[model samples]
Target chain A: MGINTFNIEEQGFLTTKLSEFIRWAQRNSLWPMPLGISCCAIEMMAFAAPKYDVARFGSEFLRFSPRQSDLLIVAGTVTYKMARVVRKIYDQMPDPKWVIAMGVCTSTGGMYRSYAVVQGIDQFLPVDVYVSGCPPRPENLINGLLKIQELIKKGVPPKRDPIFI
Target chain B: MEEKIDKIVESLGRRNIEAEIRQDPLGTEMILNVGPQHPATHGVLRLVLKLDGEYIVDAVPELGYLHRGKEKIAENMTFLEFLPHTDRMDYLAPLSNNTAYMLAVEKLFGIEAPKRAQYIRVILNELSRISSHLVWLGTFAMDVGALTVFMWCFREREKILSIFDIVTGVRFTTSYARIGGVAQDITDEGIHAIKEFIDNFPKELEQCEKLLNKNRIFIERTDGIGMITKEQAIDIGLSGPNLRASGVPRDLRKDEPYLVYNELDFDIPVYEEGDCLARYYVRLDEMKESVKIVRQCIEKLPSGPVKADEPKATLPKKEKVYTKMEELIHDFILTNFGGTPPVGEVYHAVENPKGELGFYIVSDGTGYPWRLKVRSPSFTNIQELKVRGKGNRRDDMVGRRGSIDTVMGEADK
Candidate 1:
């Protein structure tokens, strides 16, 4: 069923706020395509593994395919060469998708302020939650995921003029 | 490289393969991009596979997706300031990276770390090796469809990380080693924790071996796959377990014997077969050897200062810096300018978890190095992919996963 095709009047008045219900459901099942590029990717995997368990927040099934996922976790240092590939993957994902910049490197280039590294991935893709650490702790990554869920639940307006071609 | 690709094409031609579709109308030669995003390539490594039906005609590995110009960054920062950057190189094995860089600088300065500090470095480096091998085992098994082994391996790895947290203060990016010695001394509790892990890890390894070692599917998938001769492995400059798997036994620890390794008694594991199974076995045996080394280190653990008293080479303690005037000046000089080694060059190599992780530093009597070149094992090991990928089927790429263990952090550095 299409997300927009749901009818409120045909269903009932008991479930009056259908949009809230849709938003609630949408926030819970955020499938992330972990764009694991460097050191931060290891911590992201730790978050998915038994200890941190990102699945507890309903974001554990790491979709390598961009089409199947809505949450994009860019988890490492993004280089200038990789920026093109990142943008291409971002464009490939369907509308109503969120991006989480999962480390200091992806958020602000961290320690690597070089010609090769892209300053920040937000310049290339719209970032929802920016987890700041050299490579953030799995707990911090989980907290960032929670913040993204909160934004989804509150129904923030979709970004316009986000991402480089 | 173009000549090698053409040679591979020629070899394919001799096996009734046509170079162009125009020459043979029914030819099925196709170029497939395996990833910069795909899961099986491990971390962002893109392989362009030239295929004819199911067989791989030739494969080209495309890197620099994760290149952060670590060496270039090294030229900008001081030798001490750059220690943290090495932690990101082989992110799985930070201790080994730290020791390798530290040894190179120590050599340049014509100084040696104290016996206690050397033993501590050995313990930490070997622990790092075990943790790295744990990750390799988990990911390699996961790639081969052994799902249960991945979870099992991580379960064991978490215990090691906790042990690291006690001594190093951080789990993943542990910038623990300094120019002269480690950041802090290992406590009695830390020693006990290491002993505890050493005692417990072997039993866990036994369980893992039961799950994987004799498994028919594992043997069938990996036994004869990705075969490399001793000459090919040596010519391609493979080191660590990958070289040892081909029966070379060219471990830097045994050959060069740095960081009190000559004092420690441990055997280097070697295998006659240079297949995927042999590589896997070599790592498993190495982990046991690492445990042996750690146990010996703890037994001969010296009680003394971890950091050297050299005012020029190392940072002074916070108490000394705050209280004493001479200490204050030393601290200022150390932090602002860093250590100034002699006007010379030195190359220090260590048997890292991956392979031979070496640092070549050119010091121009400055705090910052004139040039720092890293001879990363993953960078050299990935070349074997070109040699092994030839004549193998497209699907057999998974079997020839010696290069998949290469971290882009180290490989592209």
Candidate 2:
């Protein structure tokens, strides 16, 4: 019999709701692979620091390895050259992954309208949430993380092409 | 290749050593690519380290990964429009970069900010220096596994960021400075907040020092790992705290003395040790000295107009332009035509947190700079890594973290 078809009622072991438990566990402890590139990276670091205390939300476990991480915080200017690296890191990350584009540069090319900078990273990779600012304040970063938690709790919506104006 | 090897072997024969027989020529050295995405490499710095069994044989750093072609972009944009772009060059001390670029443009226009503006610039620049060093300290300490110091340093840095947020609109990349003067005048509330930060920061610094100053692991990890001699430092053009740690008492604030720095009485700390620990100590002491300078600037701040009264060169405040007809027309002309600086090339260097951040601008009597070249300190400072990393073991790489503090943004720019 398939595991889904095998009734827990027949076994009578008193199990918790699998999807709810998975969502709760994933939402609470989202391991972030901090892909810090520039100015936004500093703000991201500040968010992880003592005063902001990213640990309070249990996302403080910044796993450098992509395989261990669920959330990718791309915090800085993503130039055309660095986009390949960003994509490689994203591809390496195990499935059910989320991306938080943590600056205007990542969401859409902020001020850098030149040949070197990638206009927006979303052309290649799917961005889940975008925290906008030249470099957003640590408080804004926290709110973005909370929003991600909310998304995880009530399943992430189907991927949509983000509008860049 | 065989002939060259034979010649080397023949030369070594007189010394009773065969060059070819020393080791098999077929043995390939292992190449380790250490980033473009490492936590310890600071920000997107890739080092291709060639190793012979844990000993770094040669290290070749790959640049241009973060290159945004800032100089080329500056050529297209108006001089005033380029002010915000300067913030990204050395993102750590954006105010310092902004000040340096503004001073360059001011020189080109043959104008100077009033005494009050000068004092405000000095205070803000010093605060930027302190904040930049705090980031270096936090990252460097974290690389060495001293997590407490990172937290302690960031706590102090958060206060500085909030201060910047109050004074300037943004927190991190604050494009606060303009050509003739600063974008906004420092209000009484901003001054009060800075004073409070200046008062409380020293105690916080002391706490940070207590955590890492004489801690056994901290010292062991940092102390003598990367030693740059006085001659080597001078030869390679190392500046800022990195140069000072090697016993060179060359500080731009003391040497150049731009913007009320001459009136300030502060001692430059120099250490003769020329090691990673000495560099760390030099930055620590410099932060205290920066506090002293900021205190002096605040006390002696003269009251006057922040922006220079040059309508052709400077745009009027939004409130003035909206309410007044003459100001609106003047703003329109200024924005559309832009300021025409004389056809001259001027290079202005500032003591950035990293090192001597110099901007070389060649103006062709147009609104846009003809040629803009940046002499970023991290560009030269990072070159010393190859020299320092040569003798150090692969494991010693982490220990040598505090020696060379390079922000790849400035380095690549």
Using all chains and alpha carbons, the TM-scores for the candidates as numbered come to 0.93, 0.91
Worst 10 residues of 1 chain B by lDDT: B13-22
Q: Which ranges in model 2 have alpha carbons more than 4 Å from their true place?
A: A1-16, A157-165, B1-28
> What are the per-residue Cα lDDT tens digits for candidate 2 across A1-165?
112434566875544577867887888999999999998888888888988989999999988888999999999888888999998998888878889999898899888888999988898888888998888888888898899988987876525434521
Separate DockQ for every predicted complex: 0.73, 0.66
Which pairs clash in model 1? none
Q: Residues B108-202, candidate 1, lDDT per residue (tens digit)?
A: 88777888999999999999999999988888887777878777778888888888899989988889888788889898888999999999999
Residue B198, model 1, lDDT: 95
Residue B183, model 2, lDDT:
90
Chain B TM-score, all predictions listed = 0.94, 0.92
- Candidate 2 TM-score over all chains jointly: 0.91
- Native contacts recovered, each model: 0.75, 0.76
Question: B147, model 2: CA deviation in Å?
Answer: 0.3
